[model samples]
Target: MASAIKRSRTSFLTALSLGLLSFGISSCNGAWRQRIGIEKQPVAEPLPEVSDGPRSAPLKPGDNVIVEAVDRVGPAVVRIDTLKRVASPLGNLFGGRAPIQKQAGQGSGFITRSDGLIFTNAHVVEGADQVSVTLPDGRSFSGRVLGGDPLTDVAVVRVVADKLPVAPLGNSNDLKPGEWAIAIGNPLGLNNTVTAGIISAVDRTNAVGEGQRVPYIQTDAAVNPGNSGGPLINASGQVIGINTAIRQAPGAGLSFAIPINLAKRIAQQIISTGQASHPFIGVRLQSLTPQLAKEINATIDLCKVPELNGVLVIEVVENSPAAEAGIKPCDLIRDVNGTEVKDPSQVQLAVDRGRVGEAMPIVVERDGERLTLNVTPEELPRQQ
Candidate 1:
């Protein structure tokens, strides 16, 4: 009986071990199938498309500012076309009688008054037999050159139109570097082209040429050919300068504009007197270089100072403001209206800021003594 009982227990133990082994093999096979990706994964349902209606993203603050400025100032910008006569080179080769050639040129301008008064660079309409002004609205009219100042390169034109859009003039003296600048003009024959940039510099003295009297505003704006005479506007859409000349070199990124304050003064003079005249102190002045100072010190013995830092009066015009104010040749100009000046251009700029018949205080070093003299400037005589 004991043997039979023992045999039954052994059989049960063996059966239980086989059952566990079978279960382990089934689990391993299942895991292997999953690891090899033989087992299929449940498919995910497709999501519905999101809809937000037809509205687009709002413009950024900078974009809004630019758009506002353009809308405000675009209508005042005008296209200027000039017709002039030129002598053909081929005709000159044929005979002494050269054939007359007609040439058309284009530039930009802005309306300054509602009665059709326009402002532009003097060179734009210089020697133009016929000037045609086209408004932004595509309306065209004949324009008459009222006046032009070549030194400042400012001109005025009058069109026979009423209720014209005019650009407001801004104070250029308030301009600062890094301020926003917008240029609206016709660049390279493209009408009403707009360019945006920042004011790179202010109070730039010499840009166009040595004779340019007005201080220039320098910018990185892309001013190309045919952009001359257009308005350089501020963020407020007011004209701060007039686009004049651009430096055309690879990677130069230099462009210049005439300050609107100076241009406005010139334009007002042209409208009132048919021409612009700058105030002068009637002295031939030259910058005091080291070599020039040495020459003057050797010859005149008046500028033998330790360090000369001012313009030297080379010649005082006879019976002029300088002579009348006791300023003589060899006198070193130290200051104008209490502003220290180092170059003759500074004196010119000071005189330009003053009105005719206005007394200007000039400080000079005469014979090792500082002398202050009051001189009333007169209008510069027009060239004969």
Candidate 2:
């Protein structure tokens, strides 16, 4: 009876041990499967919930805005492909117009008025023997030079079109720095290309032309060779300026445009009067800097006689308006009309706004003596 009881106990112990071993094996396998992500159930963490918030604004692009403008004004914009036959000096000396060599150049223009009056840069069609405009619609028209003002680098060309889309004109006086700007033209002969940027600056006066100084609107819009005469439009698609010049260097995005205000005035005069008159003060001026005052044997007090910041007359044209008004060398011009002159540039700008045959008040300091002279403004000759 004792032997049988012992046997039963041994059998129970063996069964219990087997059951424990089976549980241990199962736990080890489960852990391995979970670590390796091989279980029927997911072993990885759940993803975080996403919120429905607005996305951030994108960075402003330099080329895309201009491209957009080009798209908007596509039909109105035209390519001026011109063939200029230069009279070869040798051919001119040898007589017979040597088989005219075709020289091609590209420029851009926008239809300003509904009558098909296109405005472009003067340099584009300066001496072209034949000028033709190509539209985005694949239509072509013979263009005639209505008028050109080289001083302002603006020109008017006429084309025959039944109906035309005109670009909206913007007031340049209202253009401010940091506003959006776009340039559209046939840059590098690529028709209807647009370049975008901001008005990096405004009223820039570093431009030199025909031995004269011009205040220009500076922008960073990537203007290239073919962009000359193209429209620089604001966000509202209004023409703000006419793209004219660009610095020819990589990363040198310094480009200039003729203010639409000035261009519009010149264009109107060109279309109606056949010529535009630019006001000019018949005198060469040197800014009244300390060094300049010293060089001219003038004192700061005497230099201040003009009641302006800049130096006065360096040379006055004989019998010219300045001389006629008793303005002489060493005479400090303090003001024009009623505007105070800050520098030669400001004086020139003020003079440019005046019309020919108008009388402008000139306040000058001569030998430390203040004098008010009523100078009769004269129409500068077209040649000047």
- Minimum summed lDDT over a 10-residue window in model 2 is located at 12-21
1-384, model 1: which lDDT tens digit per residue? 000111111111110000000125876787788889998554755422111112223224675687887877799899999999987868867576568989899999998777788989999999999999999999999999999998889999999988888777777988899998999999989999999999999877767555347789999988987889999988877788999988766866689999988887887778777898777666766666666555544555333533455676666666677677777766778888768878766777876777677677888887788988887777776776
Instruction: Quote the positional error of residue 91 for candidate 2 in Å.
Output: 2.8
Q: Write the per-residue lDDT of candidate 2 for residues 107-166, one digit (tens) a residue.
A: 999887666788899999988888999887888999999888887888988888756776
Clash number for each model: 0, 3
Clashes of 2: 3
Over all chains combined, what TM-score does candidate 2 have? 0.76
Deviating ranges (above 4 Å) for candidate 1 = 1-63, 87-98, 289-303
Q: What is the C-alpha local distance difference test score of candidate 2?
A: 0.70
